[model samples]
Target chain A: MDTAQFNEALAHIRRFETMLVEDGALILKFWLHLSKKEQYKRLKKLEKNPHTRRSVSKRDWRHAKLYDQFVKTAEQAIRQTDSGEAPWLLVEATDWRYRDLTVARTVLESLAKHLSLESAQSEITTQSKPLTPTGTLPSTLTILDTVDLSQCLRAQEYSQALETYQGQLHRLAWAAYEQKCSTIIVFEGWDAGGKGGAIRRMTQAMDARLYRVISTAAPTDEERVHHYLWRFWRHIPRAGRVTIYDRSWYGRVLVERVEGFAKEKEWQRAYLEINDFEEQFAKHGNVVIKFWIHVSQDEQLRRFQEREKIPYKKHKITDEDWRNREKWDVADLLVKKMAQLPEQTKN
Target chain B: MDTAQFNEALAHIRRFETMLVEDGALILKFWLHLSKKEQYKRLKKLEKNPHTRRSVSKRDWRHAKLYDQFVKTAEQAIRQTDSGEAPWLLVEATDWRYRDLTVARTVLESLAKHLSLESAQSEITTQSKPLTPTGTLPSTLTILDTVDLSQCLRAQEYSQALETYQGQLHRLAWAAYEQKCSTIIVFEGWDAGGKGGAIRRMTQAMDARLYRVISTAAPTDEERVHHYLWRFWRHIPRAGRVTIYDRSWYGRVLVERVEGFAKEKEWQRAYLEINDFEEQFAKHGNVVIKFWIHVSQDEQLRRFQEREKIPYKKHKITDEDWRNREKWDVADLLVKKMAQLPEQTKN
Candidate 1:
């Protein structure tokens, strides 16, 4: 909000404007803002609500007090940087009705600017769309929801299949490297549902020279200071390389939203922010694959017990898991909401 | 070494062993290995006389040839996966004596032992060793002797100085990107001078973010085929960084040398055997900068004229500038010898 910070933000916006002019790509940013009183009240209500009481932490309450300063800073930053080419749309998150409507309108506007409604209609006419035939696009069974344990291989067979897949990935990686093509794969699912295990297996076959595995954790100090998208931008592979994200930017919507780690406004605006990020990746000629490993609550509990018993793996079991479990119904509702999101809306 | 097939001759050494399990601190690597023919020639020639035919391409002949394959492969790979703990060393290019001596001594000695040298040394000596003044250390000017520039500005005039620097660099660059915490600067210099204008102004007001600039040209195609680094490994910055190079690894030693690109034996060892590559950057953290801007002899003449164009600039142009001009006579003599190196060694 100071003069120097404002100028720096303006310079960044100008650079993006130049890119938009040259590349024919429009840049859109959204701010999800919640007032301090509203945020505190929401947390207080959550703590008092018997069903959701345990999920509200002392730390979260502390953050809620400083929510005013956070919003003020965000407002000034947006005002200073917003321009004709890329303007910031602020979402009022105190009311869900206002929030979702604002998001849908902003998205429709940006999409319209990128691809006019007339053009979209013409494209739709040209493109064949799929029909939901019976179980083809099941409402009850998602790609995550259908991860059957019975279909999994025995230990020996698992190793063999893993080796084969790893080899395939490795050769594919080398081919990509030799051809200077880049690839990005995203893994997301229920915690402890073999996401890391599957990733380790996939990486095993790659030529140490061709691929990298990036694990996303809590935002670092530097990462917290920048836009949420900024940290993800740093990992895009150069020509002829591959990058794998264990958990990805979707945390902004998933854990951050359901767990109250991010403000309602921030997570609410993330759908479009994420879509924009993926759009950029596609434009950059990267082959992107997203996998969501779904595990049932029963399976999650079994793994949680296993982690507690194992000495080395004990560190991975955090108090957060127990807390998240307390609001499984809410998390489930959010995940279902995320699942229903149109493919084009949030890649 | 035929004109049509000149690039293929860059294949020289096959596999490069660049890693070692050394004392705890992973020492970075730069391997400068020379073949027996080249080694014998140097030992025999040096024994007979102090002066041997100095070839321009010969300086990087071996590096360029070996660079193409190994360096590129190595750079593309994440080294930690290959060896669980130890980091690989990037072997740099040099004469046979230097290459062999470094490998046999520093690299091997560091690799074989698990002892922490620093801690052990500290334990042995209660007080740190004081610097004993040698009869005389090499003058600071010799280190900077390669630079050829007319002017420099001080920190007090930073705004004007920054404007000039940014303007000159913007004009010089073909492409630019600002990634999080990394900036890459690339420069291509001549055999000696012509690098001053770019290097002299680059280091001022550098950010804590890792900034690296690589200069490239004239390595064997064999060097070309392997890893991208088969030539530039020694210069990568590990953390928040900045690196500048005098000359980079493009030599499969041909353009000015015989065989049109580089001779058979002289530049033969580089192609598929280079060790430095993309993986290093992909796996590690740093911003990469690569530049190759060289002045022609005529431009050199103009620049020298301009240097002495005013009384204030007269001090900038020196006898060394004239001496380097004279060295090109020696340069041509060396070029002839380089033209014959490949056939002489291989045959």
Candidate 2:
């Protein structure tokens, strides 16, 4: 390589090793020295041996001739790239016993030190609870209380409005396909909220082949073994497609927090983790949309009772739903807290 | 937010969801709709409720007044971002039962389809082995046979040379520290090669605080649970330092291949895996150096015998090392094979 290329290569190499070391790797470098006369004497002996004569190729002879230049270059490399993290050792190879013993002693000492460090690190386990958004909620007060439940559309107006919007959505979906733009939509809301209904209306307008709907439930055996987001990550749509999530990663800070599935630290970290997860899509030019549907406790209760009376809907209302219903106020508090960004809810 | 800010927010949200979907998340989006008159009626009712009266803020009334513009803007957002992967669903909230039932059924059907697809994916298990560089070495012909053992350095010459190199290394290491440069060096050599001796010589020259030596051994339980490189990544040196690896990642292709520790598929992947590991270091401006020490079988055996005669060195001569020595010819073939690039080694 030329001077520039050589320097570039060295920089690249230094970067590679630094990354490894920073990640907790220890590196060792060693070079054994042999003088020109010593090397020539060794090669001549190899040529004299009938068994090894064939091994003394033209390249070996050429390399031998370039020994002085090679030594200079190697020395330059050692000087330029050597760092405190990865030091190079030059061994005088004239004495076999000394060379081997020195290397062995270094290896033993380093191993002992590394192990000691590892043990010390393991002893340090920080048990401090992460600081999260702090605010006490009155049982009757929540953001959901602000939504006017009386809002409704007449049948005639509803059909007309739905038709108009659906048609527009269908055209837009195709446009996105042509542009190769992907979209993701997340729906998180009350158990009995109209989340599913809203999703159906949108999907009905688009081509059936154009979109996919994901309904997140309890973790499966496989999902339980991995991260909470692992199951969700398995269904990401290809470009120019749609993937709708009935529920999302928000559970970590919501239901999981309420139910004690995620510890204080894990859920506290979720805010940043969730943001990071979303940031990836933004970087990739993909579209994301999230919606929260709210329903009053009375409405939820009414829906739960109606479901129990209906055969098809009965299957949807589980004992778990009833159990979760009792904690509605707590869930409401979590919802409000999760909605605010870290800065917005510092206290 | 203003028009441009609103658009930017929408774009950001879209990208976030898109990323989640791409990672296998199924996203669902839903919006509940209410007419202006209905919204006003609901807010008025809430204002009369003693428990919820305090929740009706000025913002709520202001939002009610912006209903028309809000609807228009929501429509704009839906149209601009609607894609195949993540579709939007709008539900008419007039009838509670209708809204709840539609959403529940859509969720049920979508989940069924998603589960079926997941099962189908799991059924596909491709077991094809990766193609690696291929060549055969005759037992009589090996790379180790080429090293001439006759080369030796005089005691005076060795001492002078060692001092010069050590002094340069000490200076270079501190310079590296000042520059915040990092380096990783890997040593792979024959059982009784001067790898240790070479490493000791270099470490002695550098400040004790400047460099670290990592001796790679059998994988720990933690490492076994992760990628093969996990053990090494755990010891990455900080900036302005050195890390030396005795018996580095190359063991995947060298001893692991010969010893049957790694399967064919795993060893096959190591070439790419190792390159990727180094590339990370290079990208981060860290230096990486790998050294291979070669020794004739006669010299190695002579050293092994000498070590057995010495009290401290005797501990180093284990059955594993002796067994390994018996496979010198095979090891030679592997060393040569590994040294060649894929293109050079390809049959």
Best candidate (score: lDDT): 2
User: Where in model 2 is the C-alpha error above 4 Å?
Assistant: A1-143, A342-347, B1-347
* Candidate 2 chain A, poorest ten consecutive residues by summed lDDT: A129-138
Q: What is the C-alpha lDDT profile of model 2 across B21-89, one tens digit per residue?
A: 543466667788889999898899989975446457799999999999899998989976777677787
Docking class of 1: incorrect
Model 1 agreement with the true structure over B286-305: per-residue lDDT tens digits: 44554545344676777788
TM-score of each predicted structure versus truth: 0.38, 0.36
Local accuracy of candidate 2 as per-residue lDDT tens digits, A1-347: 69886776676567656645543477788788888999899899989975446457899999999998999899888887799877787888767898898788877887788779877965783543322334354344545567788899999999999999988898788777767888889999999898989999999998887799999888766577666777788888888888999999998888887776776666776776676566556546788888999888899999999999999888888999998887776787788766655432111
